[model samples]
Target: MKILVVDDDPMVLEVLKHSLAHSGYDDVTVAQSAVEASQIIAKANPAFECFLLDMSMPEIEGDDLCYWVRQLPQYASTPILMVTALANKRDIDRAFAAGASDYITKPIDMSDFGMRIQQIDRKNSQNAFKAPASISLLDKQDQEPDRIDFSKPVHLGEITGEVDLASLENYLLQLSRKGIEGLSAFAFTIADAAKFHFVCTTEEYLDILKSTGQIISDHLAASGFFLSYAGSGSFVGVGQNANLHHDEWEKTERSIQEALAKVAVPSSLGLPSKIQVFSGVPLRLNGKYAERSLDILYRTIVEAEDRCGDTSWAQV
Candidate 1:
């Protein structure tokens, strides 16, 4: 992938370029500042496919630069990875919130950096966001929308503080670094979402998910949570205050189902579709998570979700 890297440090830039070359990424262009990066991007022949931005810059910060790139028409969905040494949760959050696809810490680990780069490159190609003009169910269509892969997590374009799964992992990783106290994770699944996927077109299914995510976001917004659609009917969230309540989940679910009931399912064979949302118990992120892989945390979430009955609530 063609990469444009922006960093103020000269030696750091050389090291990054070397690392990219080690990973077989030869088409790299480096810039000393965000302004220089913009100049390079503006003058490039075949527009750069990916970006590596330094979170800490002299003039314009990487988070602001990321937002600037995201505002451009052609590069909306392009991969933009933040390169930073700081682990302050607020800074990291701002970077992701500003549109960073993912981040790699400074004094970068060659192995982990390579993997992160490859993953974002592959993911960017796989799940492209359309940034819907309206939340209303798919606009009237002459032909049916394409079939959707119910299990593949797509890029939820900034829907109520939504970030990609990779950024979510990084957020968790940063949380672990500073002791995971007062942190908890929760998940909710649309009980019969697969059935909806069968009845709705790809675009229509996405509409349902976006709407569901919006409600969940609004409900969890009070808890200060970052949400992501984990596909397969599951929407997962991480909250800093660790306030996960049974009544709140029920209320959120009811709100989602009530809203969905109004959306007419175009291909439902005239059968009124009913939507139900179920939540699993919240898992506390404590010492165990500090030493364990974030992947296992997600697995624990899946297990917790599996323990969920129609009305049963499980605990960590």
Candidate 2:
């Protein structure tokens, strides 16, 4: 696959290029600035398949460059991985919001980076072989209005790479049946999500959803949480008591906010937009709610949405 690596740092550029070459990607191109990258892209015979961009640069920020790259018709759906030293949630969110497909924080982990590139390569290969019927179906879905029907359960594939609510419900049910306790569930919703549909294409909105899911999953991964899309720009996450404490939950909320802040609506849309999240009170998986865990979770999501008038997060 043809790859493009752009970074102001000479050492980083060299290292990335060498590593990729060693891994058999000999068609890799290197750029020191956004202008250079643009020129290279314009002249390339076959376009680059993937881009690895540094978030911090001299003149044009990597995020801005990413946005510019996304505007190019041929590269709209191509993978752009942000490689940077900004490991904070806000920076990561900005990268994704600017249209990055994935992120890698520096000091670079060559092994992990290699694995991510391989995964992208595999996905591209798979997509190249998609049946015409499948493509047509996806095209049809894209033409439809961007609305989520909460009455019916959405397949896991329809949203981000999170498990379905049914899966989370089944696990909770099993835990209840085994008399295990100390599990808690929380619901999350994206504030003013409908406005996104009005401003962004279906594909862009879906990217926002997937990025939001990834932010939540990364924060809750260490706590052994089960996160699933709860329909209509909402998510449900279940975690143990240790991870559901007031302090931990607060940290998670902050992370979510930082990530969402970068997901902005286009200025051309002529509408003020922001990516605010509303989270409900943690519902302990005990007492009367044990048997109706999924129901309780869904209700909590509704409650959170209702209470998220002008706030980043809602408590209970």
* Pairs of colliding residues, candidate 1: none
**Residue-by-residue lDDT tens digits, candidate 1, 246-300:** 6765666566667766665555673236556666656676633554646545764
Question: How much does each candidate deviate from the true structure in C-alpha RMSD?
Answer: 5.3, 13.4
Off by over 4 Å in 1: 118-142, 177-180, 245-267, 270-274, 287-316
Q: Give one digit per residue, the lDDT tens place, for model 2 in 67-152.
A: 89876767766778888888654565466546667777788889988988898899678757543110112344457443443333
Worst 10 residues of 2 by lDDT: 130-139
Candidate closest to the true structure, highest TM-score: 1
lDDT of all predictions, in order shown?
0.72, 0.68
Clash totals, every prediction: 0, 0
